[model samples]
Each structure stands twice: as C-alpha cells, then as structure tokens.
Target: MSKTPKYFIVEAGALPEIFLKVAEAKRMLETGEVDTVHLATKRAGISRSAFYKYKDAVRPFNDMLQGRIVTFQILLKDEPGVLSSVLNIFARSGGNILTINQAIPANGCAAVTIGAETSGLEVSMEELLSRALSVEGVVRCEILAG
Candidate 1:
C-alpha cells in the first residue's frame, strides 16, 4: 500500500482574520498567559479540537510556501483593450496564462483572472504580484496559489 503525501496551508496572509487569530494564539502561548491549550482556544473563540487540528497545519503567508500556482481573479475597468493590456503585462512577467474568466460588468468594471505556472522559470510570489498590480486598468490583482 502507498500513502498520499501531505500538503500545508501557506496562504494565511490573504485571510487576515484567521491569520490574526493564529498569531494571537501563538503570542498567548509564548507569554504564558493562557497556561493551558484549552483556555487559549476558548479565549480565541476557536474549538480546542480545531486548535490542535490546525496548529501545525496553519502557517503564515510566504512562510514555507511552495506550489505550482494557477488561476487568479482580477477586477478591471470596463474599458477598451483593458484585458489585452493586462495580458501583455502577464506575458512580460513570464506568466503563461492558461485560462481566463470574465463576468458581465455590472458597475462599470469587470474582473479577469489568469491561471499560469512558474514553468521552468523562477520568481517570488511578491514580484509576480507587484507586476500584476502595476498594470493599467487593473483595480486589483490577487495571486491565488491553489
């Protein structure tokens, strides 16, 4: 019999609330304020069982992060050639966009997200994100490594 490999959760920074809770719990434990794991979980409003389950599993963003990333959802302006421009930026950044999805603009803007991998190229997530955000007509660009 063979066992499947384990995976870690490394995108907590994108989720501010959960990230903060874990951080606070760590702080409490380090300072010896909570005393017991059960008390710490109660104070943090998280179940003791859940605390144990996710304690070692949860990690801060950019900490021990590793994955072949794909699929990003970008919110853009409803303007001429805005999407093309966005693609151009991705190309320049070495992202081989595999798929894109857009919704009908309801409030004078649209959203586009491209799924690409690092391929043979190597780059930090921060660099990739900065480049995406610098593109014109892009209201926001989020890199999701799922």
Candidate 2:
C-alpha cells in the first residue's frame, strides 16, 4: 500500500531551488503571465520535465486561502440605503458576494448574512469588518462562519 502524504510548512530559504522554481512556474501559469507550461518553465528557468516532476508538490502559502468563501453576519439599522452601504464596503475591497440573506426588520434592526469569496480582498477580514462597522447604521459585524 502507498504511504499517506504528509505536508510541512518549511521556510523558503531552506528549500531547494528546484522546489522554488516549480512554485514560481505554477504562479506564472495561474496569473496568466505565461500561456503554456513550456513558457512558464522557460520563464521560471526550469526544465519542463523538472516542473512536471514537482508541480503537484509545491505551492505558495497564500494559495491555501485563495478560494475560501467567508460568511459574515452583520446587524444593521432598518433604514433606506443602509444595506447598500455595507455591500459597498465589500465591493470596494474586491470581495465577491456569492449569497445574501436578510431577516425581516424587527425592532428597528435587521440581521444580514453575506457569503463572499474573499480571495481577492485588498484588506484583511478584520479590516473589512471594521470598515463595515464604520458605515452609518451598521450596528454589529462579525464572521459567523467561513
């Protein structure tokens, strides 16, 4: 039977140059900087055989969080344009809204749950929430689940 795969978070300086080159080639492919693996490997200064050998094994740390969908729950005052303002914060920061659900207004407040693909967020989650809370009529904001 094959052994289970184990992962390690090693520093870049300690890894071999080949591993780094493989990762760089992957990045170039992902970012559309190179149209083909041949070009990517050429630009990364590694042979195609070397890249193919280790391509599946190397990746950048931030890549692990790239496709994550975060759910945010915000409490806002029930007023015209209040919800739009909160959404504007996400729009400005490159957070893509996948889903939004709002409970009926009660006691002059509304509860909103927003699911956003935050991979492209220009600001950290905490900073995004802080900006949301700063908007007028927003009462409470927190990450419910991601």
lDDT, candidate 2, 41-70, per-residue tens:
999899999999999889775465456988
The candidate maximizing TM-score is 2
**CA lDDT of 9 in candidate 1?**
55
TM-score to true structure, per model: 0.53, 0.56
Candidate 2 residue-wise lDDT at 4? 92
Measured by lDDT, the strongest candidate is: 2
Worst lDDT run of 10 residues, candidate 1, spans 59-68
| Model 1 vs. true fold: TM | 0.53
For model 1, the superposed segments whose C-alpha errors exceed 4 Å read 1-67
lDDT of each residue in 10-82, candidate 1, tens digit only: 5555665754676667658867998888778778877777677667756544334334556678898899988
